[model samples]
Target chain A: MTIKNFLYVNRKAPYGTIYALESLEVVLIGAAFDQDVSLAFLDDGVFQLTKGQNTDGIGVKNFSPTFRALGDYDVTKLYVEAESLAERGLTADDLQEVMYEDEDDDWAEKPSIKIISRAEMADVMAGADVVLSF
Target chain B: MKFGVVVSEGPYTHQAVDSAYLFVKAALDAGHEVPRVFFYHDGVNVSTRLSIPPQDERNIQQNWTALAKGHGIDLVVCIAAAQRRGLLDENEATRQGKDANNIAEGFRISGLGQLIEMGIQTDRLVTFGD
Candidate 1:
């Protein structure tokens, strides 16, 4: 049988080579095939979702804007690692105006985008039919 | 099976290498074939033979070397990315007027075509980057 559920883990920054962007594209492709899909961001991967990313200084277009379109691809289960954000001195407020607050709130109930600790992440990975980390 | 690997992070001081190694081992153990392991941007460093890690730490280059030697896996380094980073084969090293080549054996220096090929042949493509 075709893999029913796929988990895509993105661990890169938003700019530079298209690793983050391209991984999201692959997730969308999987979703289009009628597969259950989710995404987890870790390490610098959390930076990809941060708000107010200024890429113009580097002579590159700001790619963070595209992240807002993920919902259209049916990729709603966005996750961020709590430790990575803290290490980078970034709170949910520092990110683009998404539901990042729920991400940092460990006590929040049924938050749209939850920030999970590394230990809590194992179950998320264990449940996927295929797990792709990028 | 379909496989897609997106390696975006550089090879130095990063978990991208370790993560990719674990995933590849798991995939192979699960009896899945990795059709494409795309090394983009800084990931092209895995193809270099000039890496010299601290003696105490595990050499990332050697891990890749062992993977290739044991499995006969196809390791393709992005040509454009490698050129940008000055990673070249023995022939390209000479042609580019460089003193030496650092691309290790068992790794082919190729282009994005290899990625597209993997997408076509495998059931899934797992990426390791950043």
Candidate 2:
């Protein structure tokens, strides 16, 4: 089987609808297929990684923790748009530290999320074999 | 190249279905092979046989039906999404004891695995949505 580059574009916030959750479900399942997977957070999607998310009042499952587990699934390349963060008044410090262990460097822990410009992100998107947006 | 199209919005309310239809039409016109068009989320609404649009406007369901009939394109609507949105096929309607089945012709209800398979099988998996 060919190892295709699967780029999942997440542009929706968590909880307004089922897109974010369902998109996450697809990613989790896609990870099992062992594809070259990477996730991009753009527009309102940047909000999905914000820290201190509380779903108690909204009655929805807090899926923010699931983002952390994505690293374990080998989905460690998370690209967050710099413009999107600026528009939302968010910084890297405001987001969760999703990290993965580096297999090449004696298991050294490294951050999975990368803050990137929209142009650079576009290049990454254009490089993908299959782009799945949500 | 084989194209896998995913429509994630409903008919009329959003332009996703219309755009997807046009994209598929253009792909076929260009002599590209579209193996499957997967409908998920509110997109399953496109496969509902009960959608009766105004006479003047273009009928979204019929557009897809014609595409399927004309090109032999496989229209696969996500079963979970279809069930949640009340877009049941004959088998599902019978199993659930519903008197009516609203799944339009040329569309079959399948699992999300079909979408994943499309990702693996096709050269490009383009998605249209809100």
Candidate 3:
């Protein structure tokens, strides 16, 4: 199959709905195809990457740790909408630091989450071959 | 052109699957090919054969099963999501030590990989969900 750019558009908060974790499932599974996979965190989705997500009290499996494992799947490039975070009274510091190993740059560790403007996010959406919205 | 369909909501709770069924039917009527429909999240609930809607109400599972049978479309329910939601196939029920399976006709329990494959294979990938 020809390589395609697949962007997963996340627009929901974690735990309240099943969209967040299920979207993550698709991303991890899609990584096996060797396609260009990237994720966008907008609306309440920015909360998904926040640090210290404990599901112990909720009695649900905490899938937040899987975000860090994306690097191993070669699925990096998490784009967070700056406006969304601002509206939620959050900053980039509030998000968990997701890092990936730079295979081309002597295997150095690099941050995957990019805090971008809404316009840049529009451009990213326009550039993708497939936009899988959640 | 070929279209790929993803239904991410269960029947009745949301109009997603209903709209998806109509969209697929419309696409087929317009002479387009819909090779597969991938059921994810709560959408896997649509494959349960045990659901019995009122006579006045439309049988959603039957509609999809009949449509798929007539069109040779592969109706796939995600195995992981199905297992989580208690909509298992015979093989899955046996493997997981469940009492019984509830998968309806024309639907098979598969993986998320099938969804990705559909995206790669089809000219257009349309998802119907909240």
DockQ metric, candidate 1: 0.12
Candidate 3's C-alpha runs over 4 A off are none
Best-performing candidate as measured by lDDT: 3
- Winner of 2 and 3 under DockQ: 3
Instruction: State the displacement of the C-alpha of residue B51, model 3, in Å, after optimal TM-score superposition.
Output: 0.9
Of the candidates numbered 1 and 2, which has the greater TM-score value?
A: 2
Per-model CA lDDT versus the true structure: 0.71, 0.92, 0.94
lDDT of 3 by residue, B1-118 (tens): 9999999999989999999999999999999999999999899999999999999999999999999999999999998999889998888889889899899999999999999999
Models sorted by TM-score, best on top? 3, 2, 1
- How well is each residue in A13-114 modelled by candidate 2, as lDDT tens digits? 988898988889888877888889999999999999999999999888999999999978998999999999999899999999999998989989999999
Ranking by lDDT: 3, 2, 1
lDDT of 1 at A5: 59
TM-score of chain B of 2: 0.97
Q: Residues A1-134, candidate 3: write the lDDT tens digits.
A: 69999999999998889999999999999999999999999999999999999988988888998999999999889999999999999998899989999999999999999999999999999999888999
lDDT per residue for candidate 1 within A1-134, as digits (tens), equals 24355677888888765667656655655555655777898888898888778876799767777666665565667778889889999888776644322333573433336788887777888877666666
Q: How many backbone clashes does candidate 3 have?
A: 0
